[model samples]
Target chain A: MADAKERKILVAVDDGLESLYALSWSLHNLVSQTSNDTIILIYAKPPRTVNTSPDGYLFSPDMMASVDKCRNDLASSIIEKAKKICREQGDKEVKVEVIIESGDPRDVICQAADKIHADVLVMGSHGYGLIKRAFLGSVSNHCAQNVKCPVLIVKKPKSSSSATGTK
Target chain B: MADAKERKILVAVDDGLESLYALSWSLHNLVSQTSNDTIILIYAKPPRTVNTSPDGYLFSPDMMASVDKCRNDLASSIIEKAKKICREQGDKEVKVEVIIESGDPRDVICQAADKIHADVLVMGSHGYGLIKRAFLGSVSNHCAQNVKCPVLIVKKPKSSSSATGTK
Candidate 1:
C-alpha cells in the first residue's frame, strides 16, 4: 500500500457520550494506519463562574480555588479517557496531542482547529430540539460554518430505531 | 500498509463550486487507496414547478416538459462532474454510485444517506450571512442533525483571506 498524506485531525470532545462516540468513529474510519495522522484531543473547559452566586452569596477565595481545581481535574480525566480510546482502538501507536481551554466551546474549538492548521475537525452533535437548539445555538453548527477546515459532525443513534427517519 | 475497511461515502453535490470542492477534497483526503471504498454521488434536483406561473398564466405541456428536461440535464451534468473528480483523483479505480432525487434538498439528502446506509455523508456549506442563513435554513445544518450517519461539512474558503477568522 502506498503511503497517504498525513493529516492532523482535531477532535473536540467533552464528557458527553456523543463526542466520545465520534472520537471512536474517527479512529475506526478516518485515520488510516498507513498515514501518520495525529489525533489532537481538545476539551473546552467552561470558564470559571462569578464569585457571587445568584442568591447574593459571595464565595471565599478558598472556595473559588477548590472550584477551579475540580474543573481542572475533570478536564484532565476527560483527556485521559480520550487518549485511551485512541491508544486501544488501533494496534499501531499514533501521535496524540491534548488541548484544554477555558472559554465558550464554540470559540475555543474553532480557534484550536485554525491554530493547529488541522486538516479536519471532528465533533459530535447534541441533536436537540429546535427551541433548545435556538437557545444553546448548536456548537457543531457554529463550528461547521466558521472553521477553516472540514468539520465532521457525528450524531449518536437515537435509542429508538424509529426516531432515525423523522427529522 | 494494512488494508482499511471499505466505506460507502455519500456526497451531496449541486451545480455550485462549493459542493464540487468538497467532492474533490474527499477524493484526496477521505478515501484510502488501500481500501476498496465506494463514492456515492447524490444530486438533489429541485422539484418541478406548478403548471401555472406566478403571473396566473397557464403554461402549455411543451413549456412544462422543457422545464423538466432542463432540470434533469443540469442534474446529469453535476453528477458527471463529480464522477470525473473521483476518477481523476486517485491512482486506482474506485467505485462510484449516482443518485438523482427530486425534493427538498435537506430531506432528499438525509433520506438518501439512510437508504444507502452510508458510513459518512460529505457535503459543502455555502457559509452565507446569519440573516440569510436564518431565512434559508442551512441545508447542511439540517442534514447534520437528521442524518443517521456522520456528516462532513466542507466549507469553501472565502476569496479574501481576512474573512477566515471572524465568524
Candidate 2:
C-alpha cells in the first residue's frame, strides 16, 4: 500500500493550456484523494545559446546576463501562476514547492523526479504526431520513459468540431 | 517533410472503450491523411502464471490456449472493425495488419514499433492520478517512455453528467 503522507507529486509545466489543465486536474483528482501529500511544479528553462567567434570564444558577460535575465523572468512568472493555483486548490497542510531548472526539459524533469524521489509524475500530452515530433521531440515522452516512478499523462480532450487545433 | 506515402502507424489495443477510441481516432486521422500508410494493430498477450507440481514442472496448456484464442479473436475483430471504419470514412487504400505477441504490453508495443520502424504510436490514457496510478501502473505512460517513435495519447471527454456528479 502507498503511504499518502509520504507521497510526492511532480507536475511538468509547459506554456500551454493543456499543461494548465493537467495542473488543475492534478490538484482536483490527486490532491483531493489524500489529505497528506505534496505538489511540486517544475518549469524547465530553454537552453542558452553560445555565440562562437573566429577565435573560438563564447558570448560576453553582458550578453549572458541579458539572456539569463530573460530566462529567470519567464521561469518566475510560470512558477508564480502555478503557486496561485496550488494555493487555491491545495490543502492547508499540503506542501507546494516551485522548481525552476535549466537544461533539456526532459532531462531536467527526470533528474528532478529522481533527486526528489517523487512518487509520481503528472504531465499533459500536447498531441504532436510522428513527423512533427520527429523534428521536435516531445519532453513528456522522454520523462515518461526514463523516470523510475509512475507517470500520469493527461490527454487534452478533442474538439468535436475539428480534428486539428491548437493543443 | 513527412512522406505521406511511406508512413507506418502502430495502434495499441486493450480491453477498454478508450482503446477503441484510440483505434478509431488513428484510422480517421491517419488514414484520411495518407494513402500509403500501413496500420499495424499489436495486441500484447497478458502474462502467464507458472505453477509447480510434485510430479514435475508442467505448463498450463489450457489457460495458455484460452488466452491465445481470446487474443486472436480480439486482434482480428478490431482490425476488421478498423478497416470498416476507414471505408465508411472514405479511406479505402490503407493497408492494415494484426500482430499478437506475448509479454508486457508496453515492452511489446515498443518492440513492435522498432521492428516495423513505425512512424507513430497511438494509445489511450485513462487519466488516473498519482495515487491510483501508484496502485495501478499505467501502460500508456510506459509506452510513451520506452518507445522510440512519437506517441499520441487520446483522451475521452468527461461527460457533462459525470462532471456534475463530481461536483
Q: Which candidate number maximizes TM-score?
A: 1
**What is the lDDT of every predicted structure here?**
0.79, 0.63
**TM-scores of chain B, in order:** 0.86, 0.71
The DockQ leader among the candidates is: 1
- What is the alpha-carbon lDDT for the whole of candidate 1? 0.79
| DockQ metric, candidate 2 | 0.03
lDDT of 2 by residue, A12-106 (tens): 87666566666665664455332356788988787774566569987798887887898789788877877777776543445788888777777
Candidate 2 lDDT score at position B102: 74
All candidates: TM-score? 0.88, 0.48
> Local error of candidate 2 at A12, Å?
1.0
Decoy 2 TM-score against native: 0.48
Off by over 4 Å in 2: A1-4, A49-60, A90-93, A127-136, A158-167, B1-167
Q: After superposition, how far is residue A149 of candidate 2 from its true place, in Å?
A: 0.3
Q: Per-residue alpha-carbon lDDT of model 1 for A98-166, expressed as tens digits?
A: 988998788899999999999899988873334545876998988998999999998777663321211
